[model samples]
Target: MRWMKQYGRGDNFCGYYRLLHETFRIESNIERFREEFENLYPCNNSGKIGDITESYFVWEEEGDDTSELIYSVYQNNRILYKTVDPLRLLPFLEWHLNNTTLAKLDNYLQVHAGVIAKNGKGIILPASTEGGKTTLIIGLMMRGFKYLSDEVALIDPRTHNIFSFPKNLCLKEGAFNLFDPLRIGIQSKEYYVRSSKGRVCFINPERITPNAIGCPCEVAFLIFPHYNPSNPLELKKISKSEAVLNMAKRLLNLPYFQGEWLDILVELAKKAECYNISVNNLPDTVELISHLVEER
Candidate 1:
């Protein structure tokens, strides 16, 4: 039960902590989505991944060493599926590991992020690869904000409970030179680094997983992280409608997908502060986030 008990029910050692869902089961690593979903997706005849007009998913208790372990979701123009991984359905499983293991606690609605907590409040940094979400999260962690997701973040829309998706903080080539002085321990790489949403990836086990479910926290802010070279690090307040749209783009399908999440998001926007998190420099970004955290 090493995989089932220890790593499966584990913690992220990085910075912040998260609770893994129990329903999300781990299966054997899938080799190809096509081969595994021959009978599932029904569009197997279409050769291209883009040809999947209607998408579906499948799971297997079969894996091989050569198989690439992925956590992805897929869907069509309608009904978003956390279908990227054939054997996995949980969109926010990254909240439970410093290392990639399956099986999670069922109480959480996971989102994609690197969230750190302070005084029962958290911020969700919603962005994909090539974005500065991870960079900013890492900086916040260094300043003692509590690392949540350098990748994906999960939330219980019903309760507005923010969940953690703990992965290694990834940075690009020049990123190390930026934060190395801040005492951030990033194992240097001559080339690129492997990551969940971007380039460099780092996982801290204790920061993610735990035996019991973590309590929901208030979302003090939703800052869409963007790095502009000349733009100053300033927090621009946004309207609730705009915040909902941005959240729609960033939220994974967990508690619910489709417009079903509208009420939840609308409420979230009204309850939580929204901001256009612009950072021209990392230090300034850290300073701004620090200010926000201090408000708690």
Candidate 2:
């Protein structure tokens, strides 16, 4: 049996890659993507251009300074997740194919892919950054829902699709506090610490969904998480068009979602239920969504 592995371990894993629909082409391995530049190809910096996605960054560290490196979406000649570890890098590389990233180098992929599942009955929680998407998903996995990508809840361009890239959930800084009761392990040194949101590897055996399979995700609810607000957890319906726009906003890879692709995705939003979940509090936020999930 000829065996080949990408990023290490599991060449036959291509089946899962296909099922997860994580397939794309590498646009190029050039020095620089943007023309207004020089010494571009062998870059060691990170930042965002353009008026809208005008994000800022610095060459935090050299890839040579890290342990193992993997450039998932090496596009527009930008350096993302120049990690000192491969495991930390591989997930994104695996999820966002070279083709997908190339399509939306400047555009980001958006979706609250936290514990998103049909769960016998279609119930979705459209959560986002700082809304405890990971926290909520980890909690649900404890109850018996399948795991999707903790961060990138990949939406398939065809099935109007949402996919599952089940793996270890990302724990950002203080976010680890919530899992105290569960006592998830944190592997230090491996994570590429960030100023605002550093990474942590957390997986609760109790929360690990047996085989960790993917589910055809359906967002029955859109919970616009509001952490630490002086407000109660309220639910409201979101319009389909509005939902599609929001999903696009949440996409880490947005640029590629253009033309006919955008049309298909927009239609998807029109087909499902959307809700705004106001979560100013963690316990309150978790409880509110738990109740909503149970109700569905």
Candidate 3:
């Protein structure tokens, strides 16, 4: 079996998927992969090319037709990750597409963060993978804060305004209890027990409300969130220089844009207040953030 298809032609993000197999159940796998990313992959069929294209190709080796599958993935013809489990293929594709598209973007400064806004000002939470960004942002959104992004914080370098990426928040199975007190329930169909990132589920921001999504806004705060149940909630001010340096390390798409990102990064860091927050309780953290937002 052999198949190829492209998604997001005119948008900033795009993906191309190709599959080759000797005699595996290709139709079933293709159907499942497309269904998984249907909502996340927006269609833009203007016949125009994007800044980046996330290319993924999976192929089985010669003379290998056993139930024990060994598939390999390639990005732009270079092998990136290989695995024996086929269930992880779709999510593996998504991870590459999300990062590459953002990395290749020239128009926006992609900060590795979660963004929530109120009163036309945005809060930037710069964190890495599993940095408590999604949990904290979800708490803020439930408290009436608008969502800009759960993935990367897209910022206009010149205007200092933040745009929305607004991808679904991917949460692990263990984190489901965090939303129980808020009366949010996870549907069984949304659960993926064998994802590339392990057992996880995607929760949309609009689950809070249709108006939960936010638009571009001036940045008000740059925060780093650290979740620790053993520690009390605390917030400490950090220097703008320190904030800029720290954020630089977390940038996903800036390296592909060359040296132009330096000035943009410096300007954005100077515009927003910087802080480090250690969170023990979600409700208390939200209250502290609300008080700070109100004070500004």
Candidate 4:
């Protein structure tokens, strides 16, 4: 691991390593690797670095003229990934960083969802991976919804208020063409091929709305978004019991609550208006949600 220090040029440091909710150091041997992620995550020097520091070493194989790069990502002195594809490295690094940060956080009950706020009221859209959470989040942001997060919703169980995570929104290739028409500037962004999600691009939330990250707000709506090409857009109000059950499937930190997780979730559901949204077209779905938020 000490050999990694000697591989890179003098100016290969990455300064933009602080997440909104957590601080972690990232060291990389390649300057481009540092630059790419720095563009996604702008620097914040406020918080102290936690226990999860990640280091990435990327270099070309000696005497190989094919320009193939080898990369190894280490988290806390242990190897988390070793691979050859340059396009795959950033996604893996980002994924590991988010997971490690979420695991280390003890204050908030994290849920697998995209969160946004309008007029200081939070909306939680819970869904599984590749379920169009990020895509819908981008639409809402464009329509003046303040961005909280595209992945995890951090809620204070005692208060039922959702806080800001505000990580870069990662969108799949299937969404590339859909968003290009909105003039949100995705065509110029570089795309990376992920093994699980196919081609993906990372969009900094600041690009969509500068200084528009929402503050901690009481949960106003809990909408479970399901994207279906065959179905038209539909938004239906759901019971609190049903919302609690659906939310349990997406809750990431249930074990942290011991046997009280259910009570916590029930209280959360009771505080927010719940709905099941069938998503087909992006603009229509966004409009529907906007109307719901405004009417409530």
**Full candidate order by lDDT, most accurate first:** 4, 3, 1, 2
CA-only RMSD, every prediction: 12.9, 12.4, 8.0, 5.0
Highest TM-score: give the candidate number. Answer: 4
Model 4 RMSD to the real structure? 5.0
lDDT of 2 by residue, 147-217 (tens): 66566555556565555545456566566656565554443222323334555544522245565555565
TM-scores, each model vs. reference = 0.58, 0.56, 0.72, 0.87
Q: Tens-digit lDDT track for model 3 on 1-296?
A: 42222211121222333211011111122334555555444433332235224435554433357656465666567887676645456566556655555544547878788999999989999987777788888888888899888778887877878888766677766676788744433444455534435766666567765687787898989988888889889999999989889888888776555887788777887889899999888889999998998899
Model with the higher lDDT, candidate 1 or 4: 4
User: Which portions of model 2 miss their true places by more than 4 Å?
Assistant: 1-115, 118-128, 185-196, 204-209
Question: Over 4 Å off in model 1, which ranges?
Answer: 1-111, 181-215, 254-256
- How well does candidate 4 score on lDDT at residue 94? 82
Query: Could you give candidate 4's per-residue lDDT for residues 130-190 as a string of tens digits?
Result: 7899999999998999999999999887887899887788988878877764443235647
The regions of model 4 sitting more than 4 angstroms off are: 1-11, 14-16, 44-68, 181-189
What's the count of clashing pairs in each model shown? 45, 21, 1, 0
lDDT of 1 by residue, 1-296 (tens): 21110112122111111223211222223444232222111121223434222222223332355354334332223333333232233212232332332123233444455566666777877766666776677667666666555666666756776766544444555565665543333343222223333333232323323321223577878777887888766788889899888777765554545555777778778887888877789887888878877875
* Cα error, candidate 1, residue 22 (Å): 6.9
